[model samples]
Target: MKRPELVCPAGTPAALRTAVDAGADAVYCGFQNATNARNFPGLNFTPAEMEQGVAYAHARGAKVLLAVNSFPTAGRFDLWREAVDAGARFGVDALIVADIGVAAYAAEAHPDLRLHLSVQAAASSPEAIRYYVREFGVRRVVLPRILTVSEIKDVKKEIPCEIETFIFGNHGLMVEGRCSLTNYVTGLSTNMDGVCSPAAQVHYDKEADGSVATRLGDFTIDRFGAGEQAGYPTICKGRYHAAGREDAYYAFEEPISLNLATLLPQLMAAGVEAFKIEGRQRSRAYVRQVVGAFRGAVDQVLAGEDPELADLVALTEGQKQTQGAAGSKKWR
Candidate 1:
């Protein structure tokens, strides 16, 4: 089997170093502005940090991918432009971009810089993927998390560029590059503002009944019973009340993580060029553990052996993990 590149997450410069040391072939991060998703406070890198991060990764033979994936607002196209410019200036191996404008800017401004289509672009079909490849010269496309293994194999046969798939972390059930619930609730757009359920608007209240109520702004997203783990107040994972059902339930999707350690060989055989881990908001410890485990797993798979992954259950969202659509044919 061909060895796929192990692309890992790096929310901070520290995490970037950690990922590289732990054996990541590449690390993807964003600026500390609205230019990328995972724009939570206390995360991402500043200008100096980005340069240093690029230098650090390059010194160790690891590539750095800058994420300029968020859409630029009408009057604030400059921010996205600056981000793309800064990424090229800092010597990022590639710029992971979503918006057509941003991709165009990068392709025109820095023709030598490689471009990877972010999953946020939601380019699943061959035609959609080909548009980016044709228009902006995107070399690699991060496939959305919704495709099954067989479906991804079929896509690889038709698309011209390399394919990258999420092997671990957030299941991302929502439609990519198109989330507005946070904007409706907190005036912050996940697509444009690069934030979802912004931490400033998140609230957890201890109810009199000992259960906790997770609120995003004034809207109560979910209520967790005593001893139950209260999840982050993301709109898609929130439970809601309905008339037919007496109890509240996940109205959009449940909170679960994607773990694809068991499918490394299949992905490699399917022509996947890269395996991405999706947690830029997590800690350095999380980066180290996940990257290390996957690094060893990929190596074992390439050697024609079953990978013995350490138990990563404790790090998963809500202590749960699933193969999602990759292992099943009935995901909706």
Candidate 2:
């Protein structure tokens, strides 16, 4: 099987260097603005930092992909446009985008620069993938974490561009680029603002019964027993009280991360061109540990040995991991 490129996350310049040093073939990051998805505080890079990061990665034989993936607001398209231009000027290898207008602007302004469709686009089917390739000249696509391995194989048969799949980190259940629950409570859009449950609005309170109540804005999302692990307060993964159920239960999805280390071979054989790690909101230490483990795993697979599963359970949300839809629809 052809070895898939390891495309890792780099929230900051430090994370970028850590990823490259740990064995990433390409590291993807974004500016500290709404142009990208992981717009959390203390994450992402400034233009100067991005330029330096690109240089550092290039010197180590790794590429840098700038993520300008969030959809641009009607009147604020220029910000997204500027981000793409800056990425190209800074010598990034590619721009991962979702918005059609952003893609058009990149194609018109930076024709030679590579374009990768972000998972936020939700272009899973071959026809949808072909449309992006034919219209925007997209060279790669980060497939959404919603398809099965067999489905991915079928998609590869029809699409012309390289396929990238997330193999680790947050497993989102809602349709990417389309979540608005955060906006409902906190008035901040994940698609446009690049933040979900912005940290400033997150609150935790101890209840009289020894339970911890997680709140996003004024709304109590989930409550956990004293001994249970409390997850980050996000609307989608939050529990709710309904239908006479006193204990709030996960109304959308559980707090489980996706770990597909065991499926590396299957993904490669299914024509996946790259493997993506999805934790730009995490720490440099996390970037180093997870990237290093995956590096060893991918190298082992490439060397014809059994790939070892990375010990990333502690890094997962709620200390739970799943293969996600790639393994089975039973997760749904």
Q: Name the candidate that leads on TM-score.
A: 1
Please give, for residues 1-332, the per-residue lDDT of candidate 1 as tens digits.
67799999999999999999999999999999999998989999999999999999999999999999999989999999999999999899999999999999999999999999999999999999999999999999999888999999999999999999999998756888887888999998999989989998888899888999899999998989988865568988899999898999988877788999998888999999999999999999999999999999999988888899878988988778899889995554
Model 2 Cα shift for residue 92 (angstroms): 0.2
lDDT of 1: 0.92
User: How many collisions per candidate?
Assistant: 0, 0
When superposed on Cα atoms, how far off is each prediction in RMSD?
1.0, 1.2
Which window of 10 residues has the lowest lDDT sum in candidate 1?
227-236
TM-score for each candidate, following the candidate numbering: 0.98, 0.97
Could you tell me the TM-score of candidate 1? 0.98
Q: How far does residue 111 in candidate 1 sit from its true spot (Å)?
A: 0.7
- Expressed as tens digits, the lDDT of each residue in 296-323 for candidate 2 is 9988988989988768999999999999
RMSD (Cα, Å) of model 2: 1.2
Q: How many Å off is the CA of 272 in candidate 1? A: 0.5
lDDT of the candidates, in the order given: 0.92, 0.92
Residue-level lDDT for 10 in candidate 2 = 89
